[model samples]
Target: MTAPEDAIRARRRLTNKLIAGREAQRLRPFFAADARLIPGGGGLILGADAIVDAFAQQFHAPGFVAYVRTPETVEVDAAGETAAETGRWTGNGQSGAYMAAWRKAAGQWIIESELFVTLA
Candidate 1:
């Protein structure tokens, strides 16, 4: 098994690939059941289903561009059950810095929450 940080990086990569492919439905497994997200455009999304729905909407939007998140750092807690990922994201003609909280459940890493702030 990979280290927690590597696992999270892999997941983030997969997330970018899924978004690029417009496979929003397949993103469900990457998030926790009750995950939350604060979008770059300024709205709070609650629950994994709602988050996935939001992605679906964005993916189908006119002139949509796939978002890519490149992690700059990942830090796992001493307990090894949780991690924090800080990264930069770009898509839809916007670029931003983002942070995601990840939790390890049943030996799998899942995103618990994410916050995005548009920098430019």
Candidate 2:
């Protein structure tokens, strides 16, 4: 495999590992990522810790543990540093677009950004 292909593979593995690990622990601290970022849950700060905390909060909601689902289709950028995915996540029959951004840090892939919206 080419270097880009290898990077894509590594990114996918990290993504899957993070998601599945969160599922296993029933915790995703950085998934939501906003309120907790601000000093007093006040404004937009977009900190890593806050994002993970948001995800964890989602898991804590009623029936939430069993609700969050990730079914994926992945595409990678030529630089091997960026990628995009489209997936279906269902709860209350409310499906929506899931967008994610990733970055290479300390020789590993990490989620730098993401958004989840609930559709009618």
Candidate 3:
């Protein structure tokens, strides 16, 4: 698949899982074991389990809804084995910006690292 196409698919996969409140399951299939998550105002969380646990906290928030903006610009590496996604998202009455790095694992794109910033 072309880089653009791959980016689209990766983004969709992420958003779908998030919307369905499947952060834990989502990581099982789409995150490296050593994945890292850095959320605004929070210390770094390493490992897929830790990352999922962190997101699960947000998932349980009352009336929390995740929204990943459409047409997110994803940049693909020349080898097509890695990509990066950056965009804005809103949930639980808070909006933020995020960037995630994805690496192909066993023929599927999986998140390797992520950095998020809350923008009020």
- Which structure among the candidates has the greatest TM-score? 1
**Local accuracy by lDDT, each model:** 0.96, 0.50, 0.71
All candidates in order of TM-score, best leading: 1, 3, 2
Ordered by lDDT, highest first, the candidates read: 1, 3, 2
Model 3 CA lDDT for position 102: 81
TM-score, candidate 3, is: 0.78
TM-score of each: 0.98, 0.55, 0.78
Model 2 has how many clashing residue pairs?
7
Model 3 agreement with the true structure over 83-111: per-residue lDDT tens digits: 88887766566778888888887776788
In model 3, the number of clashes is: 0
Candidate 2 weakest lDDT stretch, 10 residues:
32-41
Candidate 2 on 1-120: residue-level lDDT in tens?
355435544554554565544553332332333222222123444765655565556556665433343537556677767655555555534666565655545555555555566664
**Over the full model, what C-alpha lDDT does candidate 2 score relative to the true structure?**
0.50
Q: Which stretches of candidate 1 lie over 4 Å from their true place?
A: none
